[model samples]
Target: MAMTQAVQPVIRPATQPTTPARHVTVRGRASFWLFGAAACVALLVLLPLAFTLRQALGFGAANAAELVFRPIVGELALNTLMIVAAATVTSAIVGAAAAWFVERTHLPGRKIWAVLAAAPLAVPPFITSYAWVSFSESLQDFNGALLVVTTAYYPLIYLPVAAALRGMDPALEETARSLGLGPWTRFFRVVLPQLKPALLGGMLLVALGTLSEFGAFALLRFRTFTTEIYAEYRLSFDGSGASMLASILMLLCLVCLALEFRVRGLSRYDRMDRGARRAPARYHLGWGKWPVLASFAGLTLVTLGMPLGMIVYWLLQHGDAAITPVEVSLPLVLDATLSSVGLGLAGAALTTVLALPLGLLLARHPGRIATLLERIVYLAQGLPGIVIALAIVSLAIQALRPLYQSAALLVVAYAILFLPLALVSVRAALLQVEPRLEDAARSLGLNRWQTLWRVVLPLAGPGLGCAAALVFISVMTELTATLLLAPIGTQTLAMQVWADTAALAFAAAAPYAAILVGFSLISTWLLMSLFGKTAVLGATS
Candidate 1:
């Protein structure tokens, strides 16, 4: 009953599935690779728990109650939560408003504003902490910490919200307006609701930023859990106090994970499909221009101007005394840089490798397990580097004495603390790749392994590279974790800078701090360039 073949059907061999057993054999090999990747990821995630179980479980009911129910603990909890909430709300409002202005409103010179908004990300919170510490010792309080962190971390919200606004459909706004809604009302009701997910996402990021903040809290004399944990570790040496504190901090992070899952429940970020984008009409600032300009300039002066000026002023005042990068021996500089780079690269590579399997698993076929894995990453991500480092110290000394203070432990901490960056980038990349391409490869007689290698790997290579670069940058700049777990002889640049500054050798620390900032700026530039170049180019056109 089939249609008759025309012109003798250009006869072909009937061997499409001739090797059915061969396909099965190929699948077995492919599955082997899949399992290998999965095993690696599992090991990365679970290895710390294996060693740290004793420390985590060591908190008896008494210790748990003290940590959870003590007045001091309650005060710290309230303070930290206040900071998180305040920072989250302010960052979301500022970042989203800035994003909306640049991406939607007829704000002039948006490109400049966009760059300005993102500039804060380049300034390390610790350096900014140092700046504020030098700016005013007495300004070191909860309010000061909140202000500095909000100013520095708000960019997290800005970048994401900007993208979302630019990608949004202005037709919705037009619909509300046509229905007799005034501009402000339409914005608050229609536009704001549409931006809720993006704003929520930005708030989550800001909340996490505020949660893990250590340097700022330390400088401000704010006894957030991070600074408190560091105090316990340094003051008590090898004690259960630090561990108990870290476990509590971990629970705080879990709460964030729970909120994100609950609030964003079943809400896909990919709500706006293709063809949903419409350029919003620009609003002329008119007589409000001067005020807006002045506001931007003032914020810029306070946030950017004050910090840089203080650091420079102090450096120049010290002259030949404090700035010692030039005075230090070449080998010391070389050694410090090498150690930092080596440690960072090792961490980045390991994290990137693990992120891939975890990312692939989540992207290709997500389930409860994959979701749990992702939540674990996010929870760990919110932990301060100091807490994680202390936990690592406790675990290594007790359960894995042989590995204590080894480079391996340092790398392990880095992987744990910064895995979220690599995971985010890898998962994002994998999701962007269409699944149909793999099926098409199968139709073309390629087995899963062949298809993954030929199609998937190549497509994901760039993103993985970027992820590694990001992790490397983050690890290189990280201070507390490296200080804790680095081998006794290790001298990373960050450690060197901290040591110099701790000793009041400002000149000595300058070069390392400057170099650290330079390297971070380079990587951040690359990251933004990779993501924002198209937007830039489109604007140009």
Candidate 2:
């Protein structure tokens, strides 16, 4: 998950003075301690990357050159870049259009359409690929990969752009219209420029997702570096080459982070006036309304309805019968559900806990150490699940053999991968808990630890809950790491779905998919309802 600059704390008015000197000293000491702890956690996050680097570098220069100079490497890079480029552009266009129609236009059923458009997010990309491929034999290619990723990830762009659109000051658009600019001209000249930050934030997310994606690309037969890496590991047993490819992917991730930063710049979009901002005027789309409605309906059908419908269809379908009462084998479904929930909860808690020190440090300190630690987490987030899994697998085999393939190690991998999601939420929540509140607690004779326990934690509860919910949903739907590192003989709901789908047993996979989607939707609902009010939806995986 990437951090959005939009979520930074608002600058107080000139009347509010800066921190006093003594207070600054106390904060500095606290920050140093927090920084130390955060650095340790960040190293854990980077352990996999470090391992990858070692593996890549330890292979002699000739081997490295051979790995790096191959035609396939160039092909994979082109494929990945193409997918990222296409998906980012397409998702932005689609997500922005959907947001504009639902948020800025007088579209009928806007609320319903908005929810349904975003509902595809609950359907994991791999699941969407499975559904699409199952529905048609021809979807096992680049076109299918592009389509699957665009629908699956467009919501990443949609939610942020929608939020930005909702909060926008409408005075510019009104002025542009008054100057005789057409709607399209006004949108391009005035509105789109203003939405650059949100758009870039969403674009960066889509890019990162595309870079790290393994399942959808793999299932669709689109050969990206992530899939190739998996193939290298599983089929060729070429750890060195896989690590090198991962290193290149990680470098690409860094380049993306830098590019987004440069494009977003340091512009502040805050309204200067103290007056109450009026709601944006809705455009009355008379003749065009039905067409827009139909487009959104089709979008929802492909993205959300089709996958879900197919899951249910296979769940009920039997030979020569239109519908059948599918008897879900209780033992299998129950055990899988339980395992999924347990891992999800454990991963959520572990990730959130690991995230806190770093989150607090960044919120309170805002220095090089804090920035570096946070970026390390972001880098880890950008790496593929397979890379992280391999890194953890390597680490466990070398340092903790007994924990190899154990649930404990799996949870550790989850924490490593999803810790940024928690950090972003926790840091945003911590920002809301003002320093003065903690100061008041101290004035009331509470110790720092007690103040954090009584004051900050309670105030940040919603953020923590949202973080947990996000992580739980992510863990429940995660397929890559679960496929590799899950304990022997263990099957989570996702694992079962992947297994059955791999075997082309669509009917057998249907129940697991349904259950997984149900849990994911519930958790996603919790995330949006809890954190939407707080504007903490940054870089969700």
Candidate 3:
């Protein structure tokens, strides 16, 4: 044993080879371009905030404080907050209930009812207000405003909630039932909790929309911040006062978003079961079916049918001469239609293009920078359209005088206001594409750009299309921005309708309204179609 141990080898610790510390900076052309473009968009979106802050500060703090503390400011804030709270709650409840009836019950004509319910979204709030005001002078106050907005926005909640309900796993409900839970009990305790995200998202949209709404509140003679902002710009020419109000409105928007996130917290609703699951059983309304059907029918009548019916009635009463003799101003109508279409297409294309970089960045490599940029863009979206329009107006007059009152400037404003819509849609589409497919493409000798171009784009085409259609419809129906920034000679259908209605020219307004509704319906159909059968039916859950 001594002889065998005589030559034992000494062991040393293994060391990783110390390569020279080279400064390796790996960069891609695509990544560089994406980040740069995203940065530009974020700046573009933040310009309004920057200008508003500058203007608010330009007026001495004491002066700004005085402006904000006025009775008008408090009144505007109260009106705006009340409307936002009411509209969001009413929209969520009506939308979710209607969605439940359509998706989870054995109701007759569910398909038709679902389509009718969503059709109200095609009727712009202003147009609905116009219709209601024409039909009855009584619908011009708080109740009226609440009714119109609820009808107009409920579809936002309905679409997402319906989609969520459809996608939800049924086993949870089955398990609850097995534990002796009744249908309504299981729904409230089990299903509603799962719907929190969708409901919250839809409610957020509705709240922001009500905050930014202009024409409805204006026509209803409600003194919300939006109407006052318009008055300050148009009548008093008080830019500082308007800016002060906008700043307040912006703060309110931020608060709403913060509250939403706080209430939502960190809840997760993913299914734990790995295998395929069965569809949840639908509820049979049994003897309650007729009442449910009547409810939907009445809702459809008020939300969709009323506006449409009134449009027809006005057209017949005032449009008889025009309808019989074809004396309607064809050229003006034609020009306005063309203008609307061109602006819509331009806004949609530009917004979608701008959305791509942010969408891709957020989807692929989310970080603080990307998240902050996205949030900045959304802040602009949540601000009233008039605020963005006024900001652009002030900037154009100050620094870009030559561009003032140009159609291009108006398009930029549209892009600024609606870019969030396209961003959300495109990001959603990007999320659906599996990264493995991109990896597979790379393994086949394709570069990243080529992989994205050929594989990711095709997979996300439907969503992109949906984004375009939605933006187009939104631009078509837009009013406040177009009024303030459209070129001297430019006329959109929305503008025409607004002007004619303001003058009590119901017949003249009818054609523009009809055409506007037509385009909206077409675009809404496109949006719903791309989303899938239940896309607008509320099955996205």
Highest-TM-score candidate: 2
lDDT of 2 at 138: 92
Alpha carbon lDDT of each predicted model: 0.74, 0.85, 0.85
Worst 10 residues of 2 by lDDT: 319-328
Per-residue lDDT value at 531 in model 2: 82
Q: What would you estimate as the lDDT of candidate 1?
A: 0.74
Per-residue lDDT of model 3, residues 98-134, tens digit only: 9998889998999999889888989999899888877
TM-score versus the correct structure, for each prediction: 0.86, 0.90, 0.89
Question: What C-alpha lDDT does candidate 2 achieve relative to the native structure?
Answer: 0.85
Error of 3 at 65 (Å): 3.1
